[model samples]
Target: MEFLWTSFEIVGTIAFAISGALVGVSRRMDIFGMLVLALATAIGGGIVRDILVGHFPPNSLQTGFYVLLTLAVTIAVFMVYRSKQDHHMSTRWVRRIYLTADTIGLASFTVTGTSVGVYAYPQYPIFCMILGILTAVGGGMIRDVLAQRVPSVLREEVYALPAIIGSAVYYVFGYDGAWLYASYGSFITVFLIRTAAIRYEWSLPRVY
Candidate 1:
């Protein structure tokens, strides 16, 4: 269980860092700004989750591992995007990269966050679900706000729905000794749903 949990956190951190770095590049931010954005998107949700679980100071703040990892990812993204920035980047390719990274982060965090909730408060399923959803979207919300854009969850796209469903799936199957299975199931479900939503351009009804 610890291994699986740590693995998901690392994966989610890397993915979110990539997405955040890309956002910084899009905003034409400097390297320091890019690093800031990357770190925020990578660990913002986890910090929030820790607070909710009463884990004081937050794990990310306590340990420098996640911050270091995010810094490495941000630097790599900066180098690559900087190289590509000189040349005209294809909008479609950029969008694809951002979507892929963001979707992966969303899925990975959903599993990790949901698992934390289940382990922390097994008796309260709804609380678990809410934590899962918040943990999945909170970082992206922070990233978007920093970029001066509307958050994706508030957009018409089917963003939070996948997290919601994934959390529900984990809550239902995460009991007993099925935690590993539940984690993988939840991650895969969230990934596939978000990927499909992007491919199909799925969106909720707009009020115009």
Candidate 2:
């Protein structure tokens, strides 16, 4: 169980780092700025969750491994995008890659966050779902705010709904130590919903 949880966290972190760094590069941020953006987008939610759960210092800052990993991924993204941004980056391929990374990050982080909630506060299932959704989307919200854009969750996109739904489903059916498969199922649900929203421009109805 411990190994599986760690695996999910690592996967989510790597995916978030890639997506965050892509945002920085897309925004034309410098290397340092990119690092900052990546840090916020990759582990901001985990930090928030730790604080809320009374897990002081947060896991991201614990052994410094998360920071180092985020830093390395951002650096790689910086190098790649620096050379390509002005030349061939306008293709559909670039857009698809960014969307793909974001979708993956969303799914993996949702599971990891919910897992923490389940193990930490099993008695309060609602809190587990809340933490899961927050952990999945909080970093991206921070990233967007830093970039001076509206957070996607608050936008018309059906972003948070999928995470929310997945969290609730996981809390109801998963969360048992025997349900690693349940976590994966929730992950896939969120990923597919978000990806389809992007691919089809699905959004909630607006009052305007």
Candidate 3:
């Protein structure tokens, strides 16, 4: 179980970092800006979750591994973008890459957050689900705010619904002694729904 959780965390961090770095590259940011955005998008939600759960100092701060990993990923992204500066990458292709990375990050963090929340407060299933959604979207929200864009959670996109469904799946199956099933099930649910939304241009109804 611990190993599975750690695997999700590592995957989430890397995927989120890649998404953030891609955003930075699109914005023509420098290496430092890319690093900052990547770290914020990669670990912001985990840190917020820790604080909300009374885990002072946060686990990411306690260990340097996540920072090192984010740094390495951001540097790699920067190098790749720099090397490809002469090429004409289409906006559609870049958007596709970003969506894929963001979806993976969302799914991975949804599992980790719901698992931690359930383990921490097993009696409060609703709270666990909400925590999972928040954890899934918090970093992306921060990233969008830093990038001066409207957060996707507030957009018409079919975004948070996947997290909600994924969180519910984890909370239901995770407590049945089938941790692997629950984790993978939740991941697949989110990934599929999010990808479908991207492919089909699904959106929630707008009030205005």
lDDT of 1 by residue, 1-208 (tens): 8998899999999999999998888888998889888988999999989989999888877879999999999999877776774346477788798899999999999998988899989999999999999999999999889889899898848999999999999999996659877899999999999999888888777689
Off by over 4 Å in 2: 85-91
TM-score of each: 0.96, 0.93, 0.96
- C-alpha lDDT of all candidate models, in order: 0.90, 0.84, 0.90
Report the C-alpha lDDT of model 2 over 97-200, residue by residue, as the tens digit. Answer: 77788788888888888888888788898899889899999999999999888887887478888898888777766656655775888889999899888889
Greater-TM-score candidate between 2 and 3: 3
Clashing residue pairs in all predictions, respectively, total: 0, 0, 0
TM-score of 2: 0.93
**Residue 67 in model 3: shift from native, Å?**
0.6
Clashing pairs in 3: none
Tens-digit lDDT track for model 3 on 1-208?
Answer: 9999999999999999999999898888999999989999999988877877889888877879999999999999888767775547566777778889999999999999898898898789998998889889999999999999789888748889999999999988987768998899999999999999988998777689
Better by lDDT, candidate 3 or 2: 3
RMSD of 3: 1.2
